[model samples]
Target chain A: MKERIKVALAQISCKQGDKAENIRKIEDNVIKAKQQGAELIIFPEFSLTGYTVRDCVYELAETIPGHSTTVLEKLAKKTGTYIVFGMPELSEKTQATIYNAAVLVGPDGFVGKYRKMYLPTHSVFEEKRYFRPGCKAGVFDTKLGKIGLIICYDIFFPEVSRLTRLKGAQLIVCISASPATRRTFFETLTAARAIENTAFLAYVNLVGIEDGLQFWGGSRLIAPNGKVLVKAKYDEEDLVIGEINYADIRPIEAFVPTLKDLRPELFDELREAAERL
Target chain B: MKLKPSVLDLKWTEVETKIRRFIKDYVEKSEAKGIVLGLSGGIDSCTVASLAALAIGGDKTLGLLLPEQETFTTKDVEHAELAAEKFGFKTEMIDITPTLKAFYDSTPIFKTTDKLCKGNIKARTRMIYVYYYANRLGMLVCGASDKSETMIGYFTKWGDVAADISPIMDLYKTQVRKLAQHIGLPKEIVTKQASPALWPGQLAEEELGIKYETLDLILYGLERFMKTEEIAQQLGAKKELINKIKLRWVSMEHKRRMPLTTKMQYRTVGADFRLPRTLH
Candidate 1:
């Protein structure tokens, strides 16, 4: 028998700059995901205060292990479910700096968080104005497996995923608030990441319209073999539960040989040469 | 050369699904009882009202037909009422001839020949009624302004363009026609000539000096930041025509945004001070 654990993708809409209401909605879905027997529940980018916060970052940004983490800690302790969600993190090293962060918490307490490495400044995204890009990727250990975290535009950068996988993360949860225009791009990139890394992926997205941007939510769980396990409806709030087995990817990783075939030694030289450009 | 279907085509089922969800989400978030829209019996409003009916149900969506004496026609009334019945929404017709007459009687320089000023009065008058119904019923007003008109400043400010939310505002005029057909609306309604009906026999294509098909393609090219010459080459159109459209598109920027003010404050409301309306 395989050791399987269910994962829930909570594809819900966030009220922009409203942390209290957004958390209330998140809490509701956390209970529902737990009721459906999901051991790990995930929410989309800026799930705490909503994306497109603009200058409200001054007011909405929360310190890690502060109000949001403490509340999530109580929920995680009660449900016995590990949760991953996004929030605007006010930096501890420097209070003036803020980073878009993907946070993780379990039954024990807040485990860790990965600040998003890429702050997309182009087109509809003005994240660069509000966030300072994170210096490193994060992979955290838990009872289920080593889980990794990535933000919306971070999925576009393959280096982040490779670094996380190289650090021994078997499952990567990409929390996004991607809009309608970028839907096709995210869909293609997600499956590609899972197949290349030979790792399980859970993509959770925000739904609903904020101003003129209609977030087309098509949240899904992808297998190591690039197969879709479950998908949520677009432009609507949905909680989709999918099962994952940590041991299932071991053989595929061995057969595919992606991790084994990587040549970091040669890549270091290539990076040094390309740096001149 | 005509633009390819691959360039402008849409999977209307997906479009319909997304739009219905937008309507539902907007109404839900605003905590409004239902949707209210001005029904001109043209393709845009008919299509919008149909989508609203599908989004929240016919009973909740109210379509108001505000026709005046100069532009009144039985065929349009039939079309408007038929659309209401077919699309499963209720309709109430009000003769705005008296309102226009009242303004015409009271105001100075209310020349009957000055169609532009009188026409604007009619458009603004229709909005007053629309907003009144919305206020009375606690329903959000859904504007039927399409993107093509919106981009080129074809809509009347604070009148036809005013609404709590405009679901079809993202779609171009030609795209809205395709959407109307896809949703299985009546051919008569879908193919009807669009008019603002502020004046008698006033067609949008005639006033704009460009057909919707060409206008949509030109707008599409311009929106992509294609050079006027490049847009002309692709569409097989004159560069002069393309430039004319481009100039209008640029000059009409004020209509698309809030009125500009001098940046005296640290953060200006319409300029650097940016925040989503939901937060307020």
Candidate 2:
């Protein structure tokens, strides 16, 4: 039998700017994921404070060891499972700046945090106005495996996942608060990222209607070979679990050889020419 | 098999709340007093009227009965009145026969007396009244076109489809009917046959030669990328019927899209130059 790790993708609706209520729901899901024997549980972007917070994001931003994590750390300790969720972070270094950030916690408490790099400014997204983009891609070492964290819009760029994979991340988790519109794009893009990186991908999305926008919840898990192992139904909150086999990564990369074939020198040349233009 | 498909299942309460909030938000943001809709006494119009009433209260909602003298039925007018009474919305009746005659007598092109041409005029004439009242009352014109009719180009270009916003455009005709009943509309209006009421006894199913139920199923199948044969099997309908619906859906695709623009520059109006009206 292959070495399997159980992961839970919790697709739940978050109330905008209601930190206390959202935290209660998150704590409940932590207990639920643990009951199902999930070693790792993930949530959609801004799961602590709903997406579309807009101007209220400044008011909702919290420090990592602030009120939210203090409560979540206790839940992680009680459940004995790793909890990964999205929230707006009040920067410790820069008091005035806020970043759209994801935090990771485990039984021991306070694993790591990754701020989102890409702030979408077009269409329905006005994220750039509120979020100051993070400087680095983040990978955290956990008991289940080495995990990479990226927020919703970061997945649109292939470099984020590629860099995380090169850093020896066996599992990549993307937390998204994507809307119903352009849902097919998210589905296709996530699967492609999993295949190209040869890493197990877990995606969690929020659901519910707010401010005239509907967030479609089709949270899913993709295997290293690019097959969708499990997918939650759209427009509903669901807790879906899938087993990720870490052993499958090596065999898949050996066959496809995407990472093995080095093209960094060619990419640098293309980058230099584009810079001249 | 499963007699009732789960595809049509909807959380009507959640849907209603979302739409009500949508209407309320749009009206408040646009700074309009209310919304105005033409009530043909058909299921579509009735549903729109009810939703508008629920959103902004019946006192703010306006329903107009713009009936042509020859083609329009008195029963539809009666049904419209009943809906108004049930929803407590204000109503007005405008006989548009004189307006139609005024335009017809002026144009030599109208001498041939084509039904399609006359129908288009009637529809457009009603829109003129709808917008006139909407402007005078500082309200937005609500459209009654649903996804089923919208998919097959069943509406006139700038006539029946003319509106500031559509509350029910995403719902199919079958789903609209379900919503009608869910909203506690009178049984007579809920079960009434759908028609544009362009002419007397102009049944929609009769003109299309396909029932709304089957049409909705075919559309659902097509949207899901099912083959014609597979849809025929699933709906227990003929493959020719499925193919005809598919062809109509494909051919009428142009009607649902903006008018074609020849690329004159790096970006066109609705092509690469993309920004929602909200940004400006």
Candidate 3:
């Protein structure tokens, strides 16, 4: 594994439900990031379509390893750059069901995807109405490093990132379409998640407004020690690049050992109590 | 004045940044050339003008100062011109007296004593001119209905309230005042008494029967779902007054929403069906 890899976060506003336009922009970002010597380029949640896609869910939903991934895979092959992006996945098992999924594509082809586990259905978010819950947290291995993937709301749950870290992932990528209202929560939690899991956390958030909702594009990358290495501009389109020193993970983990002090066995009683409730 | 609750004090810098982004993004999304808003020389409109100029350059922003004869004042025009000068947006002086006179002439039912009707006509006339510029120049109409007036249905519907987008409507009048000052609006504009200037000697506070300083807090309490009694107790105001404010807030609900439609179909537009953000 490489000791260091540069990652680029494409914090761009999306044209809602315009897949072709969005894909064109995504490909442009990938090329730019690749030219900047970034091995991996990250985009925000629903980068293929804007987040306020209530009625267009059925029309915009595509199959995994489907057209978007296929197009991205070819672009990956051409540029030799790995890309992670968010798209609505139509469930093959349950034809009518859809999932908010994060897709990973590289020089090899489609690697894997993580469906969002937490479907936030409160406030401005009605994800439960549109998407079925994702099955589990997942980690995909690439030439860069062992990488874990999560969506916007899943960052709230510590177990998601902890499980990925315990599964031997060094970096966690969270692609979000979070708005201005919940910015402080995401910012504080991203750093906390990295500190506890002792893994690099790169958060890429959507920019621009849709349907009266404004998104604050404060994409940031946090090191294992919860240090903010780089941050994007607020409320505007900005491409921010940061280096992921894989070598620092071990020393930070060895010194802090936050992940090593885990005691999941004790949570069985609390889990049982949750079932009782 | 007693110290207001801390909740009303927003971080102006953050608020301005977010609102600026919203204006700039909405302008881009609509693919419009610039923004066109009726500048009444009030705190609300001046606040919007300052922010719009900051969001998109002042060269792109257009402020129309529509002065009718009955309520027209040199001071209003001067204040508006000051705003245009401070923020680099261009200003146009449009005398709407001719349009109002035509409305009265065309309508046989027009009454000399009906100041309310005449005021509404003036407001609607200004909208036509503002929208005319918007259509001709490919710009979007930005409305300046602040939350205090909006919650109590103080605006003339389909008149001054009509807009392609409302940038400062979410803010209360007091909040708008603070924001206006923070955005570098002159003290004359920021401290000016709230008025629609539909007729001479007309004031919004006089018509609403309450001060914005108190009204914003009542609306804030109601927004939090606080009981009228609780709000009265907390704010040290009368229960009846709080109840009255709450009634105005709820009774004006129709003003804040689209006209109701009976739902017989599986889904109805403006009820369950809504346009996608991209389409808008």
Comparing candidate 1 with candidate 3, which one achieves the higher TM-score? 1
Fnat per predicted structure, each in turn: 0.64, 0.04, 0.46
In model 3, what lDDT does residue B210 have? 85
Task: Report the Cα lDDT for residue A102, model 3.
Answer: 97
TM-score of chain A of each: 0.97, 0.96, 0.98
Over B19-117, each residue of candidate 3 has an lDDT whose tens digit, in order, gives 887898889878999999999888888889879999998989999999988898888888888998988898898888888888788899999688888
- Could you tell me how far off, in angstroms, the CA of residue A46 lies in candidate 3 after the best superposition? 0.8
Across B39-147, the per-residue lDDT of candidate 2 in tens digits comes to 9998999888988999999999999999987777888998888888888888899999999889989988795357777788889999999999999999999999999
Cα miss at B76, model 3 (Å)?
1.6
* Superposed model 1: Cα runs more than 4 Å off: A1-4, A93-96, A265-277
Candidate 2: give the clashing pairs.
Answer: none
* Pairwise DockQ winner, candidates 1 and 2: 1
**Residue A15 in candidate 1, Cα distance off native in Å:** 3.6
lDDT of 3 by residue, A1-277 (tens): 7779999999988888899999999999988888899899999999998888897878889899999889999999899888999999998777678999999999989989999999899888889988899878779988999999999999898878888888888999999999888989999999999999899999999988888888888999999999999999988899989999998988998999887787788789878988999
Candidates 2 and 3 compared: the better one by lDDT is 3
Most accurate candidate by DockQ: 1
